[model samples]
Every structure is written in structure tokens, then in C-alpha cells.
Target chain A: MIPTIPQPRLLTAAYTAYVVTFFVFLALPLVVVAVFAFNDSQFPSLPWEGFTWGWFFGEERPVIGVFHERPILRAIGTSAFVAVCVSILSVGVGLSNAFLFNRYRFPGQGILYVFMLLPLVIPGIVLGISILVFSSRIANGAWDIAEWDIEALRPGLTLVILGQFSFIATISTLVIAARLQKFDRSLEEAALNLGASRLTAVRTVTLPYLAPAMIGAFVVAFLMSFENFNTTLMLVGSDAPLTIAMFDRLKEGSTPLLNAVSLLLMLGSSLLALVMIAFQRRG
Target chain B: MKAEARIGLILLLTPLLLWLSLLIVIPHIDMFLVSLRERVGVGEYRISPANYLTFLTEPLYLRTFARTAIMAMLATLITLLIAFPVSYYIAKMARGRTRSALFLLCLVPFWVSELVRTFGWMILLRETGLISTLLQWAGLADQPVEMLYNDAAIMVGLVYTSMLFMVVPLVTTLESLPDEVIEAGYDLGGTNVSVMREIVIPHATPGIVSGCIVVFMLSLGNYLTPTMLGGKDSLWFTELIYSQFIVRFNWELGAAFGFLLLLLSSLIVWGMLRLTGHTLERTMG
Candidate 1:
């Protein structure tokens, strides 16, 4: 079949060139990152002093591979922990939110819907700092009033989860809600008509329909949490997430180790992203 | 509503309220309050506009804020201009597997952290980096040219970071436009430019607006791209906010800067929506 909006020959050639350039721009940095990960050098940039997997598996001094690096490994663990926590919390809250928006009508629903979207528009740094400031105030106020030492209220993994959940829940809600809207209400109705309780009907009928979207949202939430920087940066305590950890190391200087970790991150996230796309297609 | 239904409604509303008030609403209000207060001394505070006043009066802060706003706008505009054709090529020109592959390619780079992306740019643009090395090898320059730590480098990084965001929205919008409409335009004896300007752009307005808004917000609030690529002298407004909060231990000043950024971003996004004759809801959809 002919393509839509057929162009003149010169225009077609120009568009082809433009598309090629765009993809090259997109792929170049990632290729460079992956390539230098194996470089047998201290620096990430290259005159390509031959290839080796030293950055990924080395044990020599100053050539510590990512697996051999304690702090980097700890940072990755911290990031995974935070992502898991954020994903579970976001999806749980998102389910309630989708149910609220789709299954019920309430006063000020329109305004509340708009407010739900505010987090999406607000800058991540803004959300992070605001949460940081507000929680610190509460923590300090508790100390002044009751001598309560709620250390969890301070900047830490807890705050990171909360800050990430603030926006990511919105995304999950949108995803699940999109799926929920397309659901045939009559299936639940039929289950209810067959002497099933409301909860039973929902559990058996509705939840099954939403399974793919929920899984998709979970993967997406995990990816966003793991890759988040600005928000995580503000909320991090001593237990820094991967992004913060990488950022601190970057400020110090670039290392092939950083490239190695990045290559790993790229691989991990791409797999998760592919899972999300597959679920989206299936759903 | 019945009592049980009312209870269920309240149950659903609980999470939404807690999320909005405890997380989004109250924190923002606290931020505003903190912005208006200045710490006079230890365990002492005074309500004042002095923090904001400092921002306006300080030449460095004011200049950085202006530079950041201008740069973010330019980045947004550039992202739109660049993404439009690529998105069009994917949504209209490419078929089946090619379309999906192009779309997936757009997403692959973003899977990594922004730090990694910045690191990649650093490797490409740094003094001892590949491009400079290439230049020297080609005898195009006598020195290893420093490509990093400048506004242009910062712009490149910003544009790169935002391209995927713009492309996603534009592609979504463009995909929904029927091919028949464009064919009809051609049948009406319209040139490519005329059809594009009159038909294609009008159809993609929502996408363009949403993409611009997201890109502008991202570029404005971006921290890592500017700092990593443009170095310490980047003078990006977000970095100022960051320094005030983290380095200077001056939360009051940082809070003020944060509010100013929030306000400015809101105002700009609102203005864009109004100019484009779209609402946040409509464009977002």
C-alpha cells in the first residue's frame, strides 16, 4: 500500500536523510556508553586502547568491576529495593484511584481529577524538595512537641518511595484506568447475577481483566523509580539509590566502571521496557 | 447514597485525599510558607519576603533564571521541530514492523538513567573525547578542542534528553489522524507545504502542545544535564536551587527559588495552553 501523504522525490530523499540522522543521534550515545564499558583504560572516552571486560569482571586495584565494587553493588541493591517498594505502593494506590475515578462519582470530581494530574506537570526536583522540606518540618515539630524521634520522616529510602509514589501512582492510575474503562461492566454484573458477592465478582471477573495493565504499570513504575534521579537525589540519605550513586561518582570523575554499570542498567531497563510493551500489546 | 455506598466512597477517597494533602498539596503549601520565612537565628525565624527579594536583586541569580527560561524555551522549540518530521515519518510513512521498530528505537535510550546519558555526552564532547580526538586526527584543529562546559553543549544534552518525550506524544497524536484526510488535501490540488501547514499541523496540535509543555518543564527543571555537560559554570536555575538546598544549607532561599520555578513553569504552561486553544485536560488526553 502507498504511504500516507506522498511527497515529491526530493522531499522523500530529504525525509529519509532526516530519519537516518535522527536514529543515529539517538543510538550514538548509547553505543558509546556500551562500547567504552569494555575499553582497557581508566577513562570512559576512547582512543580505544583495545577491548577487555575489565570494567565488568576485573578484580585488580583501580580496575574494580561492578560486581567487585561494594559501594556500587550496594547502590544497585538500594535502587532495586526502592523500585520494588515504589512499584508495589504505586500500583496499590493506583488501583484504588482507578476504582475511585471509574466506579464512583463524587463532588468536586473534576477538580480532583485535575489535581491528580498536577503532579505530572510539577517538576520532579520541585516534588523532591517540597517533600524533603515538609517532612523535615514535621520531624522537627514532633521533636519540639513530644520529643518524638521519627527518623523515618527524614530524607531516606522511605522518603524516596513516597516522593516517587506521588507522581508514579498518577501514571499507574492512568494506565489501569484506561484498561478499566474498556472493561465490559456486564461481566461483573453477570457474576453478581450468578449469586456472587460484589467483592467476589470483582475479584474473579474484574481483576482478571485488569491483570495485564497492572503488570504493565508495575514494570513501568519499577523502571521509573530505578531510573529516577532528581527526586531521588533530594530524598536520599546515606543509602543512596543507583542514580544518586552514579551521579556522585560522575561528579568525582568518569570511570569505565560507570560505563559498565550503565551498560548493565541499559540492558536491565530495556528488558523491563520490552516486557511493558509486550503487555501493552497483549492488553 | 446509601450508608454502605457512602462508606465505600469515603474509602476510595481516603487514598486520594492522603496523596493530595499529605504529599502533593500540603508539601507545596509548606514550601510556599518556607519560602516566605527567613531564619533569623538558631531556633528563631522571621516572616519576610527577603528570600525572594534576594533572588530578584542578585544579578547572578536573576541572570541565571533568565538564561534557564530562554534555554528551556529554545530546547522545547527545537525538540518540537526535530520530533515532528520523525514522528510523521514513523506514523505515516513507515509500515507495520518498521513503525513499531522506529517507535521502540525512540524509547531505548531513555531506559537508562539521565546520569548515563550525560556520561555518554561527556565521553563524546569532553576535551579528550571522541569528537575532539576525531577533529585533531582530521587536522581540522591544532588542539583537542574543549566541547563540554558550555551553553551549546548544555543545549545539545537538553535537546537529546527531551527528544523522546516529544516524539512519544507527537507519534500518539499523529497515529490517530486518518490517511484519507491527507489524501483529500492532495486531491484538492494542495502542495506538500500547504497540506502540512493546513491539515497536518492542525491535526497534531494537541500533541505539539503537550510535547512542548512536557519538554519545557523537563528542560527548565533539569539539573544533571546542565551540571554534568556544562560544568560548574553552567549557571542553570535548577542548579541554583540545588546548591541552595544541599550545599549552602539555606532552605529558605532554596524554597523561594523552588516556588519561583513552580510559579514560572505553571504560568508558562498555562500561557501555552491558552495560546494553542487547548486545556490541560484536552492536551494531555
Candidate 2:
């Protein structure tokens, strides 16, 4: 109800304080990560040593404080590569699935849609284990069928990408499907009536309309793939994704270099998001 | 359909179908199969009900499941309690740029990974961390307060991660409420609290239900927050499952635990749908 008086000043103040504190709680860790990235100390703790950019651009230490390492860079590259592959595959598969489901109603459409969401509902660890078992079985069965020695199929970047795509595609499909719901079918009809082929009509009308959502879907998919841990952890081979690498480091014994990596990733993602937003606005 | 359209549909449906069949359907079937099997060794699979028996017979496993459910419920409730007023404020009172800015602030955390966010909480709640230091500095305690690596930490992590889900839907639903209904309540001499209870709350019920369901499912299925924050002795159901399959190489027990979690979440989702009178497909999608 619109009270005769505006929100009581005391109430507003209290609420404001609560919200401010909540945001502080939310933001503090990120701030700590950023701040400690420059600390000269090797550990992620308070009483920062001096502000130094050595972690980002520094010489290596032989024994312990080797902040600038090639492995970290290689892990980052692997993560990017995997994320890119997952993004493209998921987007492609998701967009097509969305198109198929939206444009045509099949006999088992409802069942199919539910099946698409099954990956989302399942526990990540279970999904990972199942995939691992299934892949191993396939590799074994193939070896038996060929009656020849075959290298054991191990979990690696390829399997990780596949594992990620299993669910990321589902998310992308949902996003694109939501966008497709409001799409005006008459535009396609009009294009078709104007002597354009169905494919041409879709290319001109449907694709343009779904472009923004598809882009958003791609970004979400990429982020999910890149930051994924549970499934990646289970499926990761000798070479690890950045998230797994960070997790392993944390579990063993973490250093401020972990904080440095976190800050770098945060900055990279934020910049990417900003660029996408700017591009969308400009377009 | 045209030949090209037929071809396109085939191309689109094939990979998704293959993915679902291989990754989802087959694995679930495998899980079910494994659930009925006997555990032999670290990574051996066989057919038996020994693992299921372990879960069914053991008080520890049952207690873990019960504890997980109770913890998830508490976290969902806490998240709702914390998120509702803030959502209402943003939806009803905040204006223009302030509203947008606050909303954006709510989403800013989404830029970071959930793992990182949980790690952030771990940092703050650790015995020697900020919270303990602050409490000591404020003279509330002689020694640093011990907070981390417990059920409370697990709840905090869950709530922190799921807060946005509760807030966003609540804000959207509350914002969409007709001003006229609120005005009508006021014209009838209703107080702010009365109007909120009668008008605002009822309108926001769908959102609240959906939000609760989302939070509950997420919390129930959550493995990371509980494992990381709850520490070794937490022994959450998912962690138990992980230990069985990954550590002990007991696939049957792990499968049984996985099925229990799945069944519980599915039942909750189903019950929520029935209670809210919303279709599961619509709500979840």
C-alpha cells in the first residue's frame, strides 16, 4: 500500500545498511583476490607486503616463489581452447535443436524436450562417472570387436569438451527457445510468399531475430564450460583445465599465485562481457 | 516439408539425440543397473543389490540423506527470508537509476565463478579470517571465532550462491503486480503491512514457490559447497556418493546414493509443481 508517509526514514536506513552489508559480503572476496594478487608474500592473507606486479610480470624463483610459470599460461590456453570448442559445438547443436523444436511439433516433442533437460537435473558427479564408464566400455568393446591391441581411451580435453557440451547445449537450447517463443512466424511466411525459398526466408528473418539471444547463449555456454569443475575434475586426464589446475593447487597448498590467477581470470571475463555489451549496444 | 527442411531437421536432431542417448539416457540406465549390482573392487562393476542394501540397512547413510534434506530446506528458507525484503524494496520502492543500479549490483556476482565465490566465503569465515578478526577487534570475543568447516558454513555458501536465484524471480514477479490492486487495498483503508500480506504476498506466491523449488533442488544436488565448506566430517550425501565411487571404488553404493538424491529432488520438484499448480516444464524451463 502506498502509505500516507513515505517509507520511514529509520526503516530505509536499516534496509540500506542491510543491503550495503550484503553487497560488501558479496564483493569482499573479489576485492581481496584483486588486492592480494600484487602482494609480495607467497600466501593469500592479510598484511599485504608491498604492491608489486611481479606475479603478472616477474622472474621465476628456483625453489618456491615461482609466480610466473609457463604451466599456468598453458593451462589458460587449454581452458580457452576447450571453452571455444565447447561453445561452438553446443551453440551449433543447441540452435538447431531449438529451431527443430520450435518450428515443428513431433509425436514425442514433449518427451524429447524433457530428455534435453535431464542433463541439467542430474548430479554433475554422476554424469561424469557415467560418461567415464560409458566411454571406457565403448573403448573396450571396440578393442574386442577389432581383435587387436588398442590404446586405452583416457579422459582428456576431448572428453572434457564432450562432457561440458552435454549440459551446456541444454542451457543454450533453453535460452534460444525462450527467444524463439516470441518470434513472429508471419515474417517467414511473408518472405516465403515473396518467392524466397524457405531456407532463404529463415536465413533473412529468423536468424536475424534470434541473433542476440544466440550470442547470449554462446556467452553463457562458454562461461559454463570454462568454469566447470566437478565434471571436468572427474573427466580430466593428465592435462588439466585452469579450474581443475587451480583446484588441485588449492587442495595441495595454495599460494598467492592462485589469487593472481583468479584476478586475471576475473579481469579477462569482465572485459569480455564489457566488450560484448558494448558491441551489442553499438549494433 | 521440403527436402532441405527435412535434411535440416535430421541434421539438427541427430547429434542432440545421440548426445542424449549416450550421455544421459544410457548413463541413467547404467546408474540404475549399477544400483542393483554388487561392489567387487575399486573400479569393478557386477550385478547385485548389495550396495542398495548398504544404504537401506545403514542408519548412517539414511541419516546423511535426512541431514542433507534438512540442511537444504533450511538454506532455502534462509535465502528466501533474506532475499524477499530486498527484492520487494527494489521492485516497489527503488526508482529509475537506483533500481537499475541495485539490480545490476545483484547480478555483478554472476561474473565470477561459483567456485571462486565459495572460496571467497571460505576466506572470510576461516578462523583467522576477516570475520574472526573483526569480532575480536570489536571485543566480542577474546579469541578468534571459529566459523568455517561446518554445517553453518555449508548453509552460508548455499545461500550465498542461490540468493540471486531467489531475488531475481521475486523481483520480476513483484514488479509485475498491478499498482491498481495495491491502490485498491490502500483505498479500502488497508495498512502497508496488511496490503503486503493480502495483496503483494499472494501475487508473489508463484515466484516464491518457484524460487524455493529452484533453491531447494540446487541445494539438494549441491556437492561442491558442502564438500569444500563442510570439510572432512561434514559427510554430505553427495560427498558420500563421491567417496564410494571415486575413493572406495564402490559403484553400487554410489549409484544407490545417486538414485536417492535424484529421487528426492524429483519428488520435491513434483510436489512443488502440484502445490503451485504450475506445470513442471513451464516452471523449470
Quick one: best lDDT, which candidate?
1
Clashing pairs in 1: none
Interface RMSD of 2: 2.3
Residue B105 shift from truth in candidate 2, angstroms: 1.4
- The candidate that wins on DockQ is 1
lDDT of 2 by residue, A155-207 (tens): 78878988888888899899888888889899999999999997899899999
Cα lDDT of model 2 overall? 0.80
Tens digit per residue, CA lDDT, model 1, A218-279: 99899999989889888889899888888888889888999999999999998888778788
The deviation in Å at residue A231 for candidate 2 is 2.1
List model 2 lDDT by residue over B90-116, tens digit each: 887688899988887887677777777
Instruction: For model 1, state the Cα shift of residue A114 in Å.
Output: 0.5
DockQ scores of all models, one per candidate = 0.69, 0.50
Q: What ranges in model 2 sit over 4 Å off? A: A1-5, A62-67, A147-153, A279-283, B1-8, B39-46
lDDT: worst 10-residue window of model 1 chain B: B276-285
Stretches off by above 4 angstroms in model 1 are: A1-6
Chain B TM-score against the true chain B, each candidate: 0.97, 0.92
